[model samples]
Target: MGRKKKKFILGIDLGGTKILMGLFDRKFGLKKTVKLEMDGNRGEKFFFNKLIDGIEEVLEETGSDLSDLVTIGIGCPGIIDIYTGTVKVSSNVSFFKNYPLAEKLKAKLRVPVFIENDANAALFGEQQFGAARGHGEVVGVFLGTGIGGALIINGHLYRGVSGGAGEIGQTFLSIPSVSDFETTRLKVGALVGRNAIASEAGFLLLRQKCPHLLEEIGYNVKKIRSGALSRAIRAGDTALEDLIRSRSRWLGVALANVVNVLNPELVLLGGGMMEAMGKIILPEVRSGIEACALKPLMKALKVVPSRLKDNAVILGASKMACEILKMTQK
Candidate 1:
């Protein structure tokens, strides 16, 4: 008789825009995947319902009963109490505050469940199966609607006091509360987290200076496609090109400070903006690091794009869940 196939784990990546779930075998090969849109306006009832629905769909598609699964890991956006499996606050999904997602999933699914911050999951995913693999100290920097950062030290996540240690997106460029209130610079998240900022912000900052080369964003904001702005740059839109360049400059400024303090050996940049505009942003960011970073520390560091594509979070979640299960078994 043929050897039976080992059942795998379920991994979920829950974000503001969508929820992605996947089933992976013992080898971590993906067996099935599903994605669901999060209609933010519909409120919490619909959100949770859709979330469960996606899981159910994947379970059915993979032909693996919930009982056959080893464990489940969910990477959720926002502040979460990892020890207690509670979601403290999620700017993406505001309804959940100190919600015990792990306990709730365990009750309903009747399986072990582990929950982690999305960025941390993504960082771990990359470390275990993607870009930063072999590195002892690494930083995952993702630039999306807002910036997200996760720290991995000595091959383990560094969850500081209160599990909110890696909220790097909230890091400020300059508060400027002391003077020049009008010229005061606000972080990208503060200016553009709610509404689509890539086009609006990029246009407003660049259009008037060079209107003859390109028009404004043209209302392509509905789809939430970040690559469009970068696509414009590649197509030779001077305004957007300049905007991306400046953004990278600021990115360097912010990241240089990170390097000075943490001095991580590797920094992997991911998320919508980095994936879309990497070519434009990388040089400027590197220049800033070279200019401002401490010589010895900066020399030892390397920044690169993440290699996991879109599966990093899910894969990382599965690995963590599997590890937890093994520890419990021992």
Candidate 2:
């Protein structure tokens, strides 16, 4: 008998500001990666064209072609309908409202495609191959342009009713002061998301607190990403440090609320900010958790930074593609 031909899987991490794609062998070995910037402009056609071109570019570089692919998987931001592979509402992705991403990609690529909420895919990746390994229950929170969250219970990804079970970002930390006595609300995303952090930095800049940071991002608040902020903090921006600590306090309190309710085996803190400033922020977050989490639960619960860095979503997405392929074969 002749040796069987090899197949590959493609995993994409579609974020608000970037698109990352990885090609993996059948054994899940990462063969190549391609990165593309997404400023979230030029509309849907622009996004789709770049996506397809990026895929083709990666394959061409790896000495392979589309016919060698087994399946494709995507971990995208926002509320996703996993069954239909549609993105219901993506605030970070303005053009992805009710987007049939999987169906559209499948039609174009002529291959099986699966989609999952980015945070869910990231948590699954960590569980299978990264920090949360061997932990059957976990809560993962990602702080970025917006917050993303997911839950895993008994070694399985838990998507609650309507696939919105673990949207910790949407939870509220304060009551709004309505002008007319009507009800109002503010979500944790607005309170601690990256944009909020940048706004605080902007406030400091207006006050002339961190001039060094001013040179880094100029006057553009949008230019102050997590990495740049981290650099400023490291350069003795104690004022910026204090500001971040305050925001981390809010996140810590919210995480405490989540832990008090769910009490998972571990809590994972990730995303751009966490990736860059984990050491600076984790202490305050733990302090917040200590203030509110149940005493007994605290004794058993573990919280730590994610180990996979930027690769979690892609790895998880590719593994999901492998699983889907197995199911189809059966």
Which has the greatest lDDT?
2
After TM-score superposition, the amount by which residue 49's alpha carbon in candidate 2 deviates from its true location, in angstroms, is: 0.9
In candidate 1, list every pair of residues with a backbone clash.
Answer: none
* Candidate with maximal TM-score: 2
Worst 10 residues of 2 by lDDT: 176-185
- Compose the digit string of candidate 2's lDDT tens values, residues 1-330: 975475899999998788999999988889999999885667888888899999999999999988888889899988889879999988767778888989999999998899998899899899889999999889999888888999998889998888876888788787666553222226788778888889889999889898889889888988889988999999988899998898888888999998988888899988889998999788888888989899998998888999887888999988977787788789
RMSD of 1: 3.6
Clashes of 2: 0
lDDT per residue (tens digit) for residues 136-190 in model 1: 8888877666777799987789878888877766777775465554332366454
In model 1, which runs have C-alpha deviations exceeding 4 angstroms? Answer: 1-6, 178-185, 191-196, 199-217
Model 2 C-alpha RMSD vs. true structure (Å) is: 2.1
- By summed lDDT, the worst window of 10 consecutive residues in model 1 runs over 207-216
- Model 2 ranges off by over 4 Å: 1-4, 177-185
